[model samples]
Target: MPRPLRSENLQGTLDLLVLKTLAARGALHGYAISTHIQQVSDDFLRVEEGSLYPALHRIEGLGWISSEWSTSSTNRRVKLYSLTAAGRRQLEIEQKRWDELTLAVKKVLECYG
Candidate 1:
């Protein structure tokens, strides 16, 4: 099996994943967002708290997302993050770029391997 993906390997795409996750799931806390990414990738990708929290704060400052403090189901306090209108628009742009990048990578692998 392939080695698990670390957050350092996802430097440029974390914001895209976070935005898409919020877009599809509505508001979610940092841990939930991290869980969603790991689960959906079938455990291939693991997002650590160190990287996730900073990305959350950075994305929020960009105005693409917003957050509020809320109580979780376990009665613990958490910061809930949701995508903004601007984020939805940015998601489209990010998706296109991702698609193009993957396609280029696929072409190279198909030719050389």
Candidate 2:
């Protein structure tokens, strides 16, 4: 059986995942973002609420994302997050960095094996 993923490793990739999620969906509330990540990962990834809010706030402060209190489709009030123009640009840069990191790690693992 495969070992479960650690939160420490997930922490390093949370921002990228969040950016991808917002980019793909356009806009999403905090709860939806967490739920989507968990669902899409088939429950392999567990996004803790504690870590998620801080990351959201950090990205918003960086101007990579914007948020507003809006009503969801179910009519409940929530802070819906969306990527700004700057955010999209940043996402492109980050995605490239992530791809590079992934490739480098893969190469290292291949060499070790």
- Give the candidate number with the greatest TM-score: 1
Give all candidate RMSDs, comma-separated: 0.9, 1.7
Candidate 2 clashing pairs, residues 3+ apart or interchain: none
lDDT agreement of model 1 with the native: 0.94
- What are the lDDT scores of the predictions, listed in order? 0.94, 0.87
Per-model TM values vs. the true structure: 0.96, 0.89
Q: For residues 51-81, could you state the per-residue lDDT of candidate 1 as single tens digits?
A: 9999999999999999999998899998999
Model 1: residue 106 alpha-carbon error in angstroms? 1.1
Q: In model 2, what lDDT does residue 90 have?
A: 85
For 20-97, candidate 2 gives per-residue lDDT tens digits of 999999899988898888889877777877888999999999999999999877898999999999989988988999
Report the lDDT of model 1 for residue 31. Answer: 89
Candidate 2 colliding pairs, count = 0
